[model samples]
Target: MNKNIDNFVPAEEPSKDQPITVLMIEAVGKCNAICGYCPRGQGLLGPETNTYITMDLLDKALDLASSGSNHAIYLHHRGEPFLHPKLDEIIRRVREKGFYTFLSTNLISATPDKVKKVLTAGINQIEMHYSAGLTRLPHEVLLKRIHEIRKLNWELRNFGCRLEMNFSLFGETREIIMEELSRHTYYDETLYVRWFEPHDWPSLEKIIDRGVDYRDCHWYKHKACAILSNGDIVICCLDQFSHSCRTNIKDIDRIDWESLADRRMCQGCTQHVEMNWLEEDAIDMPLWLTRKQEIDTWTA
Candidate 1:
């Protein structure tokens, strides 16, 4: 989550003792974009009402994770994360709690004020998610927001939050967009771009399949944890829209930290080939997907 990315070893290198490096808290569960390949595009998100995860709930999750190795929280999953008005405040609190934080947003809804506050809010990293070289807004408008963010060189370094771009080759002709976006630099730091194929992400069935080769499992190698906006704690980012969660944040006592890395559930995700489940996090609709829900049924 944070740029400090600690000890991500090869799958064979780490013993079972590898630390759970990141914790995902979906503070906001709504997105401004409706990318067709995403769960939201397929109409499969959690409840629309009361979608913001309040500070109290967040603290509970943090309290549960207090004893873990590398206490970093990836701010959210599958939504325009900045939709929450108190995003800066949330990041500040997480930092105060002795945890690291990062955000991945579409930046379609970003404004100059929001950008400045978020950059200065003690967040360690921020990433812009662009699919087919565009967010929900026109490329021109998206460029304007990028301009807004890039101009904050001082805030970025002062607060420790640097920027990066994640381009999904899901759209037709994403090359031009990637080339255009990569041309810009942020705070003397190159806007590192991570490219992944949405089609390459394995289906839930394949991801859960025990037969998928262990070598293709870079995604689950470095363990991570996740808590939904509504307070439920799932195994990892792959369960973003799935209800097969271990427990809710309120029920922190039931957490099984050691069992997180034993994620046969995440075996096949490709993590952008490694399926870096850390940066990517998703879902649809106003209601949460049930444990019995089948996302495979809703496809392009």
Candidate 2:
């Protein structure tokens, strides 16, 4: 809100000769709740302890993405962006560099105070995750929970942040389900809904099994990349294990994040060459939000 956070034109499409890079900086290394889909829950990914991206590493991330003509920076990947102590700093810095910035959270921890702090911190768009079954709460309880969360939608609207609720998975009954769910949050006009596709899950097995040649993927063609919480640059968001990671952002010299296509981790990788690679239209949110690390501790 302090700078030009509104009236952003969609970035010009990059040519085949030169592709624009959309960077996803994994702000936090830990999550509160464990869902079945994420590799973090399956014990395949995530750090042994809670870790966060440092300010020094964040500057390096901006420099890497700003090397291109026009780009965006998403302050999330597997963990909640709010988990990072410097989340506001991260979003504010990305906005300062004129990148379309975003944040995603389950909103389980999004209290009024925390919501106001983040919405005023220069975020252009924000997405919240919604999945009823994962919470293990009764239907009525879940409804009440969403009702409380949606109350803060007014604040989000006040700051002009595009707020969308992402359903965890796609299903035949999505139309009817979303319609019924929409009734709870009908108070705000800024709210939009998106059906999260199945493949959006952070599973190394599924990606490896169905993956075709790595060259055909959007990450290879469009230069879409992710820097893990530890500053290691991987091929894409799904590379949570850093299997395809080559260079760390601390020593970032070259912009070619996909320079190591021949890595064994890329064998039979995903063929997803589309906008989902460059910009996540629908960001997936975690099931649980409130953790031991409170938002007040995340000071500048």
Candidate 3:
């Protein structure tokens, strides 16, 4: 990870006085799906503890976040948020506190009733992840599920809920996934195509048959900070497993995003790599110029 920081320029320092704009809470530490690359699925985090974030902790985190500025709260990190029993209540409470809420799920447990409950609870945005390479569910079945949620979103237009689909590109499903993206009409405006990142315990050769080397990326620190289920505030979501990179959430306000160690960790993340490229403007080529139009058309 340290080797990757060589070419990376640290992101501009954030103002110490400014409030955090994004906060990710690991609402739960367990997930229902056993994806090949995730820490939970690979047994790196051990058997499901069935842990859920208590309302008290949620309130404290919200208070800390609210003290600064208008922020967005991501209700997940490593776990299946829907499994949290109090998911609806969590969403409603977060909304009541005036923070925008986002949840990402595998959509395996997203029944019609469950979907309605969350939308009514005021989830500003929900993202569903689908990976043909890892998911046991059939492709057509997942596509149907996507359509169901989109129809539900249309019906609840008054709430202005947004939906997004993320497809993790892999060797076995690359062509089919692209075909689905190009041919299918998504109800939401953006479809995220992600390259699988390599992790420990999940044999790299098996997980990433082909993908970019993200060792030198450094963009996460500028975006958000993650609060793990154990209440440790890590530099970013990708560094959850590294204890050396964490501090208690109580110390969040004192930590610096541009610290040398944090920068090194960010330099090794794939999400940071993707975000960096998305923000870069080349001399002979302008990327952001077409990013919006391309996304709009793809979503449309």
Candidate 4:
């Protein structure tokens, strides 16, 4: 597992005077799938709607983590990181810094051989959100790939690594959802089903019906955070619309860690932070802003 630090981002002062437990980085900014439920429309934001956090900026983030943080870094958000040219390098750098790293893929591009390569590269976890039903791939091919990853004991159990599945909540038929969930039973791995939106028509019920725990993965648990390619940090990946900033590792050190956590853009999942002063204000914020009769209006 290449340990060369040639592309390593230098470490800096801890963001909050100490090392944080978890640092979720959106190294790859978009996705390969055009799932109907994708909240952040692909190709609409940056770089074909898939912007990447450059190697230089990532090195800056590594330099910023204090000696105290043993946090695991997740390479996801916005896009498919496996498609990044320097993905292997990014993984190498993070592991070299002694950080437990995770790369969540859509499982569409993941081949068993590719999975083995990443496993050997010191990835602490390899998670996938299988979009078989939502993608254009034929059902047989998609199922085969899912089975392939599920059988990868070499990457999961043998390496003491974690493998998780993220089932995106879309307007899929009930039969499809059940079929996808059942695939987990066929594999020797764990699964995590995440909802696209709460009020998206009995989604909570579907999760409940599946007997899947409804703990909000990114929001409710407060277990998730996003660092943009430019180093902009936000509370939860989904809360980007509320109060996201274009920050860097240096910028993280400049702000009050706790104060920064006081997200003013959108109130994160209710199960996490109690409705605070900032969240309340955000809730009252305008739904739209009018700039010109034709192009300035913003809609939720």
Please report the candidate that would top lDDT against the real structure: 1
Q: Per-candidate TM vs. native?
A: 0.71, 0.72, 0.68, 0.62
**lDDT score of model 3?**
0.58
Candidate 4 residues 71-95, lDDT tens each? 4567776567777777767887887
Q: How accurate is candidate 1 locally (lDDT)?
A: 0.59
Task: Output the TM-score of candidate 3.
Answer: 0.68
For model 3, the stretches where C-alpha displacement exceeds 4 angstroms are: 1-15, 20-22, 48-50, 68-70, 132-134, 178-223, 242-246, 250-271, 276-300
lDDT of each: 0.59, 0.57, 0.58, 0.50
Q: Tens-digit lDDT track for model 3 on 1-300?
A: 123443455545554564443367778877888776776676676553446788877766666556533345788877778778788888888878876677888877777778877876777677788762236666556666777777776675442665767665444566765666455454232444454544432332122323433234432333345666656665555554543233555545444554323443332344544444212321112343334223231110
* Model 1, position 226: C-alpha lDDT score: 72
Off by over 4 Å in 2: 1-22, 132-159, 170-172, 179-190, 200-211, 257-266, 270-300
lDDT of 2 by residue, 1-300 (tens): 012223322222334467436468778877654656767655665355256888888888787777653445677776767666667778778777767577777655555566666656656566767562344333344445445545554444342455666776645477676566556533342546677654544545432535455555656566566777777776677666666655676765655634334234444454254345353342222222123113312222
- Scored against the true structure, residue 68 in model 2 reaches a CA lDDT of 57
Task: List the candidates ranked by TM-score, beginning with the highest.
Answer: 2, 1, 3, 4
Report the C-alpha lDDT of model 1 over 55-173, residue by residue, as the tens digit: 88877777766655544677867566789988988888787777657788888767888887766666666788866226456656666676677777343443234567776776545
